[model samples]
Target: MTESDLTSNFPQQSGLPGEKRTDELGMRILKAAQTMFVRDGVDAVSMHKVAKTVGIGQGTLYRRYPNKGSLCMSLMQTKFDCFAEAINEYLRDAANATVFERLSRVVSSLIRFSENDLDWLKAILQSGTLKDAKANIFESPPFLFIRDTVQRLLEEAAAKRELVPLDPAFASVLITSSMTPELMFYLFDSGYTPERIAERYVETFLAPLFAGAGRI
Candidate 1:
């Protein structure tokens, strides 16, 4: 689906015209929930505390989300539009690059995602409560946010012999393997700059993968 579709479907709390009609009270509840979910784990946040935080009653919180998982899901959905835009922007910016350049940037995008959007991602990955929400095996992953864009590139890569012929999904996963911030986190905790790791990543893995890859 287009980013416009994601935007239209998952209405934000930041005053979209048709998104929810946010009165001051609803906005307060939303803001409070964002703070709570980011600050505390989803399981730890409660309806009562949400009510207290927004100066509303438990009845009011229920008016928004029937339960905590749904409430937090709503919070995540709210953030999806902005995240989609950022990813699409990066993909567009890399559009004119060579296949290898695009793949490198997509890997870079994954690492940036892990570092920038850690808390919301942690909530989604850790919480299975939202699994029934029209889910996919990969939807909950922040990487899957850009899955279509990356997957199509993989398909073309295999078609053109850019890399060894592989399943698009597997190739995409292979390209992203161990390029996470968790890997970077280890590097950082053990003291390595993001730049050094990225340079090493390209030389060690990416260059060989696409040495003479061309359009199919």
Candidate 2:
């Protein structure tokens, strides 16, 4: 199916009181599913189990989310929104900081988010919604947000003579692509902590770009 077809398949409730209740129930479903997934692992949690946890009927839950992947996408969307807001706030607060420092903080924030939501992210990737989409994940909002942020930072650094002359657009893609959930999960399985991964990622992938800038 086309990307638009996939997106449009998801339910979109309207109206006031009904919409409010639907939103509340949706939040409850997400919370219950997240708790179960984090505690029992995604493979161990069933939709029936999630419905039971949320005190909703299986049919009710199914109406909202046809499958676990759909539910996971909703959960990931919630987390991504908050993460994006936090990154925006951080950037605003650190506007005067060196470009490298801002980039480091943003990248580290992203790593922390990935580590925290690992299971949900894994389920989303495997769900086929993204895999089957015509545009794929590179065109997804979350990826675009990070890529644009990184690209803007790189451009700022270049303007300040803090970064080496390079194509910010391609460089941003290189940096953001490296932080995919698949690679992060591999690193985690390889016994690397999020902090360690973030550190090494900054040092290896980002440091050379701003080598002469000197860390503040």
Candidate 3:
């Protein structure tokens, strides 16, 4: 199926009481799966293992997520949504300032989030990087969601004359590629202060992006 068709199938529902319950259950299942995948490998973590970790029967896991692909897709989507919500919330509540101020706040929040989820993210990123892997996890809805969000903001910034007129797609890739938590983990493994990494990140990537654009 096409991307639009695929996206149409994953509806967002959470406000209703029933949806809230499902949301809670989904989160529990996702966390269990994440733990298992991190401790073991993605291929090693089965629906049965996730069910066992969540203290539920295999039937329940199957009922919720019929297959491995579906489970992984849902798990990534849920986790990414939650992560993005946190950043969006921080941006919304930030003190009155320019959009640049809000972006700075969100970027710092992202750094903190990466540090908070470092272990699991590190493991997953390393394992998921294998070229032989069957599933292209990065091509899933979750990644697309984040990419789109970043792209939208880039487009908005350009339209408002806060940033130069560049292709939103390339800007999205640049932002995400530069700030990816896994990159920071790699940098640390190679020996660099996270503080320095973050500082240079803004100075190098972000500062240049805005330099050529007119301010709103």
Candidate 4:
């Protein structure tokens, strides 16, 4: 996949609430699945195992999540919400910061999330069911939020004469292209610390824009 394609933008799926009892049961099933996946690895966990672990019938588990992909998507939804919230919070707090500084902070946050959730994300991407579901990661809500945030930053910088004129959408894509899991993992494995990766990312992709500004 192209770098842009690899950058997923899936929306968070919300659980339906039929009744209090059903909601509680669904929570139990989801918790069991998460626990098992973390303890035994995603590839080793199955619907049957999760049902047995949660003491629920296989049919019941299937009713909630027809396949591993559905369950994985639900699991990731919560994480993505938190991730999005963190970025929002950071931007709010850094309102007075320079565009470069704000961009650096966002990059740093993304690197931290990638470092912490690499395995979980890998499992979701490797799931055949998710692929078959044809969920466009680029259209996902969290991704869209990140993309829009970056675009806004780029536009702001250009408006403020801190960056040369450019298409914000294209610039946002270029910035996020470096934040993909594959590239991030390669950099991590190559002995680049997360901080170092963030620094280099800013230096390579952003510094020149600011340095040359109108000249560029």
Query: Per-prediction TM-score, please?
Result: 0.60, 0.82, 0.59, 0.79
Q: Candidate 1 regions off by >4 Å? A: 1-28, 35-47, 62-70, 123-135, 139-144, 159-161, 173-208, 212-216
* TM accuracy, model 1: 0.60
In each prediction, how many residue pairs overlap at the backbone (N, C-alpha, C within less than 3 A)?
0, 0, 0, 8
Tell me how far the alpha carbon of residue 4 in candidate 2 is from the true structure, in angstroms, after superposition.
33
lDDT of 3 by residue, 94-188 (tens): 53566655665556656655665555454455544333433654575545665676786677677778886679888776676566555767877
Number of the top TM-score candidate: 2
Write the residue-wise lDDT of candidate 2 on 73-186 in tens digits. 886776677678779998999999889999999999899888987877788777765666545768888999999999999999888888877999999998898887889999
- Model 1 residue 168 CA deviation (Å) reads 2.4
Ranking by TM-score: 2, 4, 1, 3
Residue runs of model 2 more than 4 Å from their true location after superposition: 1-15, 38-41, 212-216
At residue 54, candidate 4 shows an lDDT of 90
Q: Residue 179 deviation, candidate 4, in Å?
A: 2.4
Task: Give the per-residue lDDT digits (tens) of candidate 1, residues 2-50.
Answer: 3233334443345565555555566566667776766685567878999
Highest lDDT: which candidate?
2
> Which should have the higher TM-score, number 3 or number 4?
4
Off by over 4 Å in 3: 1-77, 94-96, 126-138, 213-216
Output the worst ten-in-a-row residue range by lDDT, candidate 2.
Answer: 1-10
